[model samples]
Target chain A: MKARDLMRRDLTSVEPDTLVHEAVYIMEQSGLSTLPVVDEEGKLVGIITEHDLIQAALPEYFEMLHSVTFLPNLNQIQKRLKEMAFKPVSEYMKEVFSVHLDDEDLHIADLLIRKRLKQIPVVDGEGHLVGVIRRIDILSRLIR
Target chain B: MILTVTLNPTLDKFYWVEKLPLSLERVEEEILIRAYKSWGSAGGKGINVSVFLACMGVETVAMGFLAGHTGQIILRDLLEKGVTANFVWIEGENRTNVTIIEKGKEYHPVKIHEEGPRIPTHAQELFLKKYRRMLKRAEYVVLAGAIPPGIPETAYRELALEAKEAGVKAVVHAGRRALWEAVKTGPFFVKPDVREELVVGDMPVRTEEEIISAGKKAIEYGCSACLISHHVTGDILITPEGIWEYEIGVPPTAFKNLVGADDALVGGIIYKLLQGEEIPEAVRYGMAAGAASLEVEAKMCLSPAAIEQEMKSIKMEFKEPL
Candidate 1:
């Protein structure tokens, strides 16, 4: 099977200027962990995932705390989240990583496993977004 | 893509009522009235222009500050109408302009325009950043309409200058301070909004001579051309080379709604320009578009066919060389 056979065409995507809060709302409603970010021409540029959103709520230096027990106050996290809500998705979207439709299903599954990605965007030869294939899609094929 | 900016956008709500009470005599009573028909749409000079352009199958992106629930409605409307959205989200509710048209007074609709949200410093910064990025793909950037609260008076000046830097042609459709600021940047064209006050910048535009002088002043300020609305049925275009008058055969009484006529004119001109037409011919098409919108009740007459039909009656006459 090829990636095209497993990819879902109807997907929720966002523009770079979409507010973080609105992006999160779309993600929740669509039940998707990630959203592809496209430009006005509908060309894929980046992706925003749940991990990126949670990371936006944490401070830059939080990772360097060496797993200390004493955590940052809730107020501080709330304040950071408030600021992030108004910022555009461009600030939080991850670097683009996509697979072409002609790519083999095995190759996509291997990349997904190695990269530990929940979903991978499917693009055409010209880099325009065509669809997205999720890890669950590959796993469900065995049951079917 | 044509990028149109409406810094202060509105959701226009229009109602067709049988009659509107002239006097509310009792202060304690909550008077109730019913409307036979009602409609709402995304509004703002730039948005109106975008709607018109989209109807003509032109790719246009509308950018500005949008806020609250009303902003969502406006964005949805723009998307449904085929105009790409790139608005910066801000805090506060977008204003809604209400118009009540009585059965016999369709020509004299009572309009109440609200003041929209105040843009904070951060939102303004974000908008400029997005604007610069979008300018990369735009053929022309149209700066139209009123400047909202908390925005600098030099907003149009800065935007026009940025468009110039980006090598994109800029068309400024504004009035008063915004018009004055943009005129200094030598935009491709300048259309002064003289609806509220018959004035452009500090000059009075009430008389034909004053309008000509004001247009000349704008030309002196570095604008390539200045188009001023002379009356309901005509407009005057002044360039460094010569002046031309554009008039439609329709009378004022023939207009169903004059609200979005100016925006259609600007949008029509840009649409024609994108089709590789010259400035004179584009302005003629734009006049026809304005006349077409005047005959309809919708914010803009969205049919290119209608605009073409109206174009047949447009009279363009060259007055004299400047």
Candidate 2:
């Protein structure tokens, strides 16, 4: 089946001007860990994933830490989060890798496995967002 | 930011067909009716208002209940129009309201609307929580359209009251019980839906005198302003200061579609209000937006230039209430 056939078209997207807090609320409500950031022209500009938000909230020297428990207190992390909460998503949103509607399911599955992505945004010929294809969607469709 | 609530939203699908058969007599045989053109957009009274406001560069967030596959299409369209979505996902499917326009009969399109999904108790609670959070950032909140099943009719009242507590101006663009309920909370503005009924509760708005009386009654109920439709090309606005008549100089025959004209009017007014324009001037811009929408094939007048041009043909006259 084509990506269009198995894609979950019900995903909600965020705009670039959307605040980080608002984006988090939408993600929580929709049960989505990643949200495609779309611009006014309906083009997919970026994506806000759980990992991206975590990186923004974490200290700059987080990767250098021996362990997460090595942190003295969460005050540093809390302050970072509060400061980033009101900022626009565009500040922290990362570039998104996408697939077209006509892309073969096997190619999408391969990309998901190689890239370790949970979901890939689907765009039309003009790069307008169509929907998204999750790893589970392809697996379930293939199994069926 | 302007926040809009549409309890019952739909995916408005417009199809241009050569003809619409009165009946399908052959039940056993397969029949095919082809459409030459088709368009779909997010629709609901408040949703339409949000879309128009977004197009005008006003920050707007649309809050409502969305469900199933139909909800997906609605969300995509909303994002495309630049309106932020903060809807609660519920069980069942969102509605698909179809408008079939026959060739040369563009003025009179056949509309078929489905009653949308019922809002469960949990969904209602979740929506209120989200609404309160959104209210903190909203300068104005618009409660519009019909109240869907499983949701209380007093929902708008509760919301308007909360907005009042938050110091956010509330605009109620609904009719019947929903209008009456929200009016009691003393909204910033109330525009009664006169399409289904010519009354705000028991108040008759069929005649000019009666329309003024209805508007007065709502104002007496604590609303700042009350706007009622007078005719196809005219509407009457009543506020504490005085009454004003808005009329577009163009003939009614110039209208091609009247679907989202009222929404455009409300949105235009809010857009101007956000720009610090007074109520009268804002309403004038709104009337022009409605007139512009009337002349277009699309549901709304998307071009700011078109609305500006239509303003030249709109005339606003003040009057003493009878």
Candidate 3:
């Protein structure tokens, strides 16, 4: 199967000026975990995922402060979260991944495995958001 | 004059694209999207209230800590909306909020907030100093939104108290921690989300009865009135005299890409209250404004004439305070 045949035509996306906090709300409301970040011209600039947001919201030293001597500061983490509350998603979205409409499903799935991406956006030749294909969409290809 | 204190403000941008993919497995990673449309406007709780107030023909002033290029954009937009502003200059840039709406039948709406710049101690003082001067001439003062870092939770309380002492009614909408402090100052009114009871008040208010009981305690602390907004179930209004339940009768007309519905509610209430309308009438006006915002694609308020028509469908039931 090719990406065009397997990819779902519907896509979730946001603008560069969109806040990361509101992105979380959209994901939760829509029950989707990923969103493509587009610029004013509708060009796909980056992609944001649940992991990207959670990691960005956390304090920089969150994983490193497990020691009892200097425990993780709740106040610092709260401050980080509050700060993230007003930040735009353009700051942390991944710009490296995207797929062409005619790309083969095998290549797309291989890229998903290599990058550990949950969703890959399908775009037309003009870089317009057309659809999306997730990891499971092509799993049937391997099974059969 | 109505003074809106948005300690932190942002540029709100909206982008319309396609319907969201529900299942993760259904989509590919990279997609180019042709943005059908995009828009930007004023954001921040107090700023939104000011925008709505201006739409209702009220003279409103927006105040807050602003800095950098993003702040300038917000200031320019505020002026475009006919709201005068005097923001305290601070270091770093202001934040931007993005709202993404999918254009299909679902009308999926996703919002993202940027982590705003932190205000320095000196900048905080400058803002408060401005607050002191403006409170003296203000007829109504609105305190709203999340308290930015380095600013104490008591910030709203202090502002609200200043308004009260000046014989101006203060309306505050904030989270639990700030709400607790603000209620003690006894602004004319306090409106916290229904979930706030668990976060800031003495009880968890899921049902109507619980909301009234918890809201009463908040009112008795300092304010003359309180409102609890439950977006889906509707809202509850309480005062020392009695309590009332507001039924929008229908959901917000436009849910997608609709921001500031709550702020419009706050603005509508203040508009009617300043005109000497009763609490129930004011509450109705608030509901209509909120409903009007639901259908709009941008973060703009409905005109009073339009809201007046929507107000007819709102039903209010006065449940005597328990």
lDDT of each: 0.85, 0.86, 0.75
TM-score preference between candidates 1 and 2, better one: 1
Q: Best by TM-score, which number?
A: 1
**Could you give candidate 1's per-residue lDDT for residues B63-146 as a string of tens digits?**
887888898788768766877666666767899999888876766889999989999887787678768877877899999998
TM-score of each: 0.78, 0.71, 0.66
Query: What tier of docking accuracy does candidate 1 attain?
Result: incorrect
**Candidate 3 per-residue C-alpha lDDT over B213-289 given as tens digits, one digit per residue, 9 for 90 to 100:** 77788777866788887445388888888888887755433454457878888999898998999877898889888
* Model 3: lDDT of residue A101: 81
For candidate 2, write residues B267-318 as lDDT tens digits: 9999999999988889999999998998887999989999999999999999
Give the CAPRI class of candidate 3: incorrect
**TM-score of each candidate's B chain against the true B chain:** 0.96, 0.95, 0.92
lDDT of 1 at A73: 61
lDDT digits (tens) for residues A1-144 of candidate 2: 787676665436777987898788767656689999877655789999988988889887887883668788989888998999999999999988899989998899999999899999998797866678889888887788
